[model samples]
Structures are given as C-alpha cells and as structure tokens.
Target: MERIITVRAEINLFDGSRSGKTTGYKSGIRPNHFFEGQTSSIAGDIQFEGQDELALGGKCFAIVRFLYPEWFPPVVPGITWRLHEGLRHVGDGRVLEVHSGR
Candidate 1:
C-alpha cells in the first residue's frame, strides 16, 4: 500500500483546571513536567515504528503520531507519522517554532 503526508500532530505541554467530575482545560492535554516523586502521572518517551504513511480506507495518505492517551476515544481515523532523512521531496528542515515552558 503506497502512502503520503496527510497530517501532523504537535504534542505540547498542558496545565489543567479541576472542576466537579472533570479535571482538565479544554485548551489541551495536560503534560507532566516536574517530579514530585508522587501521584498518577504520565512519564515516558514516544517513538515511531514502521513507515510514515497512512491510507484512508485504501487511499494513500501521510500519518503523524501524536501522544494521545490510549483511553481517549478514537476522535479520527489514521495516525501521525514520522518523516525520514534524504528520503524524498522532504527537505533539510528547520525549527519552525518552539515554546520552552519554564
């Protein structure tokens, strides 16, 4: 199955606001920053395996991987894929933007 670049997901830091039953900001997902050496938290590395491509019910497309919680419902189809070096039309990229949350 051939494929191409279709989507990209940016996994960024998040802070939450606690209320009644739910405890999160509608803005984005909460990221664990510091180590209190306590409470339930998500701390791990995300690595991409296999090729960076996706298909829509058999149509070729690109897949980008986002660090979405497994418990989260499948909001959409396909995935976030990673691009390789010297592979094709893709370039010697540069840092477009970055936010160092301190």
Candidate 2:
C-alpha cells in the first residue's frame, strides 16, 4: 500500500541548476528527494506556498508529498534534504514539519 505523506519545508534551489534561471516554478513538480547517505531518489511532489509560481534560488516554504515516505529515513524537524533531477542536485531543504506519514 502507498502511504503518501506531506511535509512542510524551507527549500533553496541551487543557483547553478539548469532551470535555476527560470523566473518561477509551478507547483506539482516531481523532484527526487535525497537525504543523508541516500544513493537513490525518493519520488516526491512539491506544492509551493499559495499554489502559485515561486522563484528559484530563494528560500521558499513549500509542502512536499512523498509517494514512498517509508522508503526514507525518519523525517523530523531540522533534518536536511536535497532535491535532485537525475544525478544533478538542484535544490536543498530542511524539514519543518511532518504533516503526515506512515
């Protein structure tokens, strides 16, 4: 069974990312979540605050939904994570709240 989870976090996209120059990113973007020592990407969706486009490279609070939250290590406040596209590290974030989980 899929136990999806929602988490609120403050994210910052790397200024060097390919899409980093884009003015804004829409919600519902599927970015891989990578935590410490993790070698694989955990599928997740990002819902930016206000459900509107958000500027990259700036600290932005967002709600992320993990499709396989159980596959990840225990998520708690202050735990940092990285967002990736394939092998490229696009952004980074810190967990603020675990809204729901398995």
Candidate 3:
C-alpha cells in the first residue's frame, strides 16, 4: 500500500544575495538542523554535547569547538540570533537564525 502523508513540504534554497535571503539553500533536502553561528553561546537542537560554561542557559551551546579557527565565514559570524518560523520556546530544539548580514 502507498504510504499516506498529511502535510506537504516546502522548497528552501540558499540564494547568493548573502544574508539568509529570508530563505534558505534552494532545492535541497532541508537538514533537520543547521549551524546557527560560531561563538561561546549556542542555541539549537542538541547533538553529542556535555555541560560547560556556554551550557548555562540550559539550551544547546554554540558548536565552536568542532570548527576550524580560520574558517570563520562572513555570512556566519561568531554569534547569531535564532529564527522561528512558528511557535518557538526555549529548549524546544529550534535553530537560531542570525540575519545573514552580507
């Protein structure tokens, strides 16, 4: 039998305009989550993590430990503000959508 679905998905793409274009990477499988920013402060769904200084807020800490120091991209700075398309609550595992300042 064919699997039944109730909701339709939207197509999100990343335009070259820089700052998240009020959109996302086009025509790709939307990742369950993406890197919010690079800083001591993190806010998003937790992965393999533990308690630390940046972990005080009870939310996911920014994943700065795993990235290269020189890889700091302009579009993605050290700190970013999380974005919510709908209802968002602390510790809800929502990703911070920092306005991509081009």
- Model 1 misses residue 97 by how many Å? 28
Tell me the tens digit of each residue's lDDT in model 1 across 66-102.
Answer: 3334443332322222222122211111112222210
- 51-93 per-residue lDDT for model 3 (tens digits): 3222212333232222222344433333333323233211212
TM-score, each model? 0.16, 0.82, 0.21
Model 3: number of backbone collisions = 12
lDDT of each: 0.23, 0.77, 0.27
**CA shift of 50, model 1, Å:** 16
Clashing pairs in 2: none
Query: Which of the numbered candidates is closest to the native, going by highest lDDT?
Result: 2
Model 1: worst 10 consecutive residues (lDDT sum):
88-97
Per residue, candidate 2 scores C-alpha lDDT tens digits across 20-50 of 3445557888878888887776778888886
Deviation from native of the Cα of residue 17 in model 2, angstroms: 6.5
How high is the lDDT of residue 86 in model 2? 74
Question: TM-score of the candidate numbered 3?
Answer: 0.21
